[model samples]
Target: MSGHHGLYRPGSSVLHRLPAQVKLVAALLAVLAVVAAPRHQIWVFGCFAAVVGVLVATAGIPPRLMARRLLIEVPFLGFALLLPFVAQGERTEVLGLPLSIEGLWSAWELIATATVGLSLSVLLASTTSLPEILNGLQRLRLPALLVQIMSFMVRYTDVVAGELRRMRIARESRGFEARDIRQWPIVARGAGTLFVRCFERGERVHLAMLARGYEGRMPMGDASGAPWSAWATGLSLPVLFGLLALTARA
Candidate 1:
């Protein structure tokens, strides 16, 4: 419920106003359409990116925040870049380096698809609160156990992170600087201590919840209602993407 919790940006944009379930489905559909699209038709991926870009703009997401979140894709981008060098196929020269022709095409497709997919996910998370997302999944008939697990993970991740941070500060205060490999054992022990503390904290939390009348599942309050207009507005982009993908396949 904190103002800065997770990736939920405070805004009144139409994207922010849409029901969480609607946004979830819209994102899923858009990702599926991106995956379904033929790899050779690179223009289709461009169109997909354009659509997601417009939505991100409409959502009023800050470029800095988006850029920071997009850092998650750096590893995937690196792998894609390497494809041109390692993949076996017809060879071509670029900047005096011989590369596979097929690898170039494959890399392009990988980068494009990854960008679109990750963007859609980032957009969804940026607009929807973690609690709202969990509620939305419950409404969407996602498995009860799976939803519950996700809910707990989201709730405790911050606590675990705080514990780790405090441990780091304590180490720094004691003048224990991890400057080299010799200090790595100390770092590993710190990590092990953090794990034990997190485990104890989780046990205490579970016991408290049990004593407070928590059953196997957390009580989700009333589901947010989605009107027809909301559904239509939310799904418009995905429908367009789907049609384009189908057209490209045809």
Candidate 2:
């Protein structure tokens, strides 16, 4: 696994030392707090963002890398932007344009909450490896089936991606041009072929695991609970932010 391969950055910072379960719980609570925050108050969101920024810096993650990870929220941001126009409410004029006041608040809340939540998640991902995250989830008492599903999703994501790359290579080699809409059928066919290949690959992987004495529940190599200090260090910032959110809401 290369340093740049996945979200986990190799580091020895305090954030890295803290166990995954603590961080996972802290992040989840903080996100729920953000979702419950008063939408009209910009300061609450700014405070949450500041907390996330501090965590990112402490983990030694690069700003550019975090910026790239934030692209996942862009699609929802488009819908959030549209809310100002499409949603009906009291109009607030800005720059000679009529916009709904309620819509503006709704949009602001959506964008700010999503940005903060994603930043927090990205911070956790940057600090914890996938396997460790799975361990943490199991420790947190999540349903075995849900954990297994997520484990498979994380494990096979790269395999499926590799299969797609091979398919694309074969397509281009066979004189398939997908640069325009005229060749969309070819692209659709390619996608279908990739799905079939992925299903077959899944079957093979399942059988191989069974042959290797695979069971429904995979053992976590190190399932030890995090120390009190780890919990204190991990939960402090989010707890502070959660209090701030409550105060702001009140």
User: If scored against the real structure, what TM-score would every candidate get?
Assistant: 0.90, 0.88
In order, what lDDT does every prediction score? 0.87, 0.85
Please provide, for model 2 over 103-178, each residue's C-alpha lDDT reduced to its tens digit, 9 standing for 90 to 100.
9989998899899989988888888877778879989999978988888777777878998888889988989877
Model 2 residue 174 CA deviation (Å) reads 1.2
Clashing pairs in 1: none
Error (Å) of candidate 1 at residue 129 is 1.1
Candidate 2 residue-wise lDDT at 40: 82
Instruction: Give the poorly placed runs of model 1, Cα more than 4 Å off.
Output: 1-3
